[model samples]
Target: MIRVVVVDDQAVVRAGFRTILESEPDIQVVGEAADGADAVSVARRCRPDVVLMDVRMPRVDGITATARLAGPAVVDPLTVLVVTTFDLDQYVFAALRSGASGFMLKDVEPEELVTAVRVVAAGEGLVAPGAMRRLIVEFARVGWPRATGPLPDLTARERETWLLVTRGLSNVEIAAELMVSPSTVKTHVGNLLAKLGCRDRVQAVVLAYERGVVRPGLP
Candidate 1:
């Protein structure tokens, strides 16, 4: 089963997510937390496959919680799915940068939520929700001020794969785009992720923007 820990300040929200996720035979809600502080402790104890984290919890925000749970320094990190009520919440980007596997708006349909947990659990962060797509368009237009370039030593093909990943394309889509097999795209993605120091696809997407490998008004 795909064990999940639901973390939110609102009791109803936690209950609602638990209900929705547990409805799936492949998913089980193992625990719940009312805030980020409790979330860390509960997650540590439960060691869930997926953490459904709220963005604006008291005591500690989702960004910090995600960093603690899944940052580069973490050993055996857990996958985190940061959820926000607002689509354009800037903190959601921060959570992504902090190593969340992915994110989605809280108001998403129950079916989408279930699929998100399954996708992240399967180690593919991007699903049909398109949260990463919104992040890319928004960041591409606004442009981060910390203009810095210098991607790690990436081969020509690896760089191309990295760019497609930044666009939030899945391995299958990337394979079709590059006219290669899905396995080849997976290899490129794995190699590029190792070079870029990203734990998952979404972090790689964030790194693309932060490194200035991709930017506003530029492809």
Candidate 2:
């Protein structure tokens, strides 16, 4: 079972997520929090696989909470999925920089929410491709994680995998595109992420954008 903690200020929202998530046999909503401070406390105690967070709470908010749970300074970072009613880029950028594993709009369908949690749990994230690319590019300009300077050496196949990832292809799609197995693509993805000093695929995409290896709206 994939353990999850849902954090939101509204009781109804929390309850609704729990209902939707628990309906899936693979998912189990283990806990809930009403605000960021409590979210930190509860998550620390539960140590769930995924923390579904909400921004703009009364105390601390999701950005700060995400940092507390998964920031670079953290010894053992937890996976965080920042789900917000607001679709503003600022919140998305802040959350991602602070170590969120994935992001989603609260208005997304229940099935999408479930899939988001599963995707993050299975180790791929950043919601849909188009919006994720836009957010990473905008954040790249701000240069929070600093994807500048010389990129480490990468194998030709790894480089190919990286570009396809920047284009928002999943491992399965990349496998088919390259005529390679999915596990091979997974290894390539992992090797490339380590080489790029990226914490995740989202940051790797940002690095490519910052380095001008890829540009906006090019197919």
Predicted structure with the largest TM-score when compared to the true one: 1
lDDT of 2 by residue, 1-219 (tens): 999999999999999999999999999988999999999999999999999999889878899999999988999988999887656677876787788887888888999899989988877666566566666566556544435678788999988998898877888999999999999999999999988887778667657766877765465
Q: What would the per-residue lDDT of candidate 1 be over residues 123-193, giving only the tens digit for each residue?
A: 86652336655655666677664536666788999989988887778788999999999999999998988
The whole-model C-alpha lDDT of candidate 2 against the native structure comes to: 0.84
Considering summed lDDT, which 10 consecutive residues are worst modelled in model 1?
A: 127-136
Q: Itemize residue pairs with steric clashes in candidate 2.
A: none
Name model 2 segments beyond 4 Å from true. 133-147, 217-219
lDDT at 219 for candidate 2?
55
Clashing pairs in 1: none
TM-score of each prediction: 0.89, 0.86
Question: How much does each candidate deviate from the true structure in C-alpha RMSD?
Answer: 2.2, 2.7
Computed on alpha carbons, the lDDT of every model, listed in order, comes to 0.83, 0.84
